[model samples]
Target: MSEENTPPLPGYEGMPLAMLRHRIRSLGEEDLHRLMAYEREHAARTGVLEVLTARLDAVRQGAEPSEGDQGFQPEAAPPPAGGSPVGPASAAPASNPPPHGDPAQPARPKGDHRPGGGTRGGR
Candidate 1:
């Protein structure tokens, strides 16, 4: 499809399924059709198609567009300017391994060998 027929929503192609569902609620049937057509002509994703079809069906059944600006996507908002707040001071102390092998199975005594020289007792 040409640019003229692009989906009504800006950044439509990049929208995740959940975001699309929320964004499309504010759109009318005509705009939904346009988006559905664009989706079918391009990606034709099954999940997207299902969402579009379900919404269209709802619209055709007299469901009005929900309140909210389609362009106002909080989910797509950029992360905070500063990087992570975690610092060395807030980090957990490093752990050291046990000196006597794993905690689950403690190391045997120096002369605790079995008769057959096996490490496990009898069995």
Candidate 2:
């Protein structure tokens, strides 16, 4: 479709399905038709088509355009104006395992120091 035939809502193509549904409430029947046509000609997504079709049907059955501007999308607000607050001072200390096996169970010394100090075969 030509640029003139674009969907009435700004950033319509990029809008999430939920956002599109809410935003389309402010559109009249004519605007919804344009949007539905544009959507069918382009993406033709199932969910988007369902939303448009349902809204169009509602409008045809005397559902008036809802209050508030379609362009007023508070959900699409700009990102906060600064880097993350994380810093070295706020970070947790590094962790290192004990050099001698596990801390819970220390490694045994060199040779076996058995009770009677006898060799394997009772030598």
Model 2: lDDT to the true structure? 0.84
**Which whole-number lDDT from 0 to 100 does residue 119 have in model 2?**
46
Task: State each model's CA lDDT, in order.
Answer: 0.84, 0.84
Q: Please list all clashing residue pairs in model 2, or write none if there are none.
A: none
lDDT of 1: 0.84
TM-score of 1: 0.59
In model 1, state the lDDT of residue 5. Answer: 70
lDDT of 1 at 26: 80
Q: In terms of TM-score, which candidate is strongest? A: 2
Residue by residue across 10-110, what tens digits does model 1's lDDT show? Answer: 88888899878878888898888888888888899999999999999999999999888766677766878987889998999998878766799876666
Cα deviation of 44 in candidate 2 (Å)?
0.7
